[model samples]
Target: MQRRRLLKLGIGAAVIIGVAGAGIALIKPGLVDGKLGPGAREVMRAAAQAVLSDLLPSGAARDAALQAQLARLDATIAGFPAATRKELSDALGLLGTAAGRYALVGLSIAWAQASTQDVQQALDAMRLSSSNTRQQVYHALRDLNVIAFFTEPANWQAAGYPGQREIP
Candidate 1:
């Protein structure tokens, strides 16, 4: 009886999440015609701050770095195949919405208003969630931020990677 109840609860939760994700994707997609729309950028910007809290600089430099990271994120996501891009874009769209944020990220506040600490805590929750879906979301967001920030040539040095040398 307990197992049956748990199975029912899991199915119910999955359905709710699917409906919410689909609604967000239809109402306000994160990407459009291969472009990184505002919705996607908002989610990426917030997630980057959370994932790179320690690595990102402080004060004005941090603001500049975040802006640059968003640009990098746009370019990195653009390179993904259409299907993959669409899936990621939809996930970002879901995260950008208020209901989606509360459901998936555990954040009740808007991304624009969320402090780094708030976002970090929410991400930590997602990382530790028993739900595999939430865990996947955590990894995807973290990996995306890491990839976007590290892809810059200037950042390569900081990560201990010297630029490629020209072979004679």
Candidate 2:
């Protein structure tokens, strides 16, 4: 009976450790890579275009700025807490899926294929959505995009902020 009880206890301990390991793996999925997958990156690019359209110029300049901004965004995401990273990862993954895209953004087309106007409309709807989840997702993307856009020194001039005053 003593040997049987010890074996049962060992099995239970192994099960607990297995479950915890799986949970941690789920929470940190791909975070160590420090970059978004292609589909996720496309979604973020479309989102940035939609959110910062007024600030972003048309043509090659806009594309160049967007690439820099995405790099900044990726760096920012890489430093986020595990829970925040997980949430953002989950949201991005959902945005990449056709069904999730339609459900969340009301668009049948893939995010990369969606027109600027269409992407803007979808983001606007999300911003004004009654659902808390939708609004949260909108806010997260919007905040990231705005931060990435305004943090660039080139944009500071446009925003009317002179270079930092040197402290003597």
lDDT of 2 by residue, 37-121 (tens): 6767888899898888888778899889889888988888887897788767766766666656776677787887888899889
lDDT score, residue 50, model 1?
89
Clash tally for model 1: 0
Return the TM-score for each candidate structure.
0.86, 0.76
Worst 10 residues of 1 by lDDT: 32-41
- Stretches of model 1 off by over 4 angstroms after superposition: 1-13, 162-168
**Candidate 1 structure quality by residue, lDDT tens digits, 52-158:** 88888899999899999988888888899988988887888888788888888889999888998999998999999998988999999999999988888788776
- Candidate 2 local distance difference test against the native: 0.77
Clashes per candidate (backbone, < 3 Å): 0, 0
List runs of model 2 lying over 4 Å from the truth.
Answer: 1-32, 166-168
Best by lDDT: 1
lDDT against the true structure, per candidate, is: 0.86, 0.77
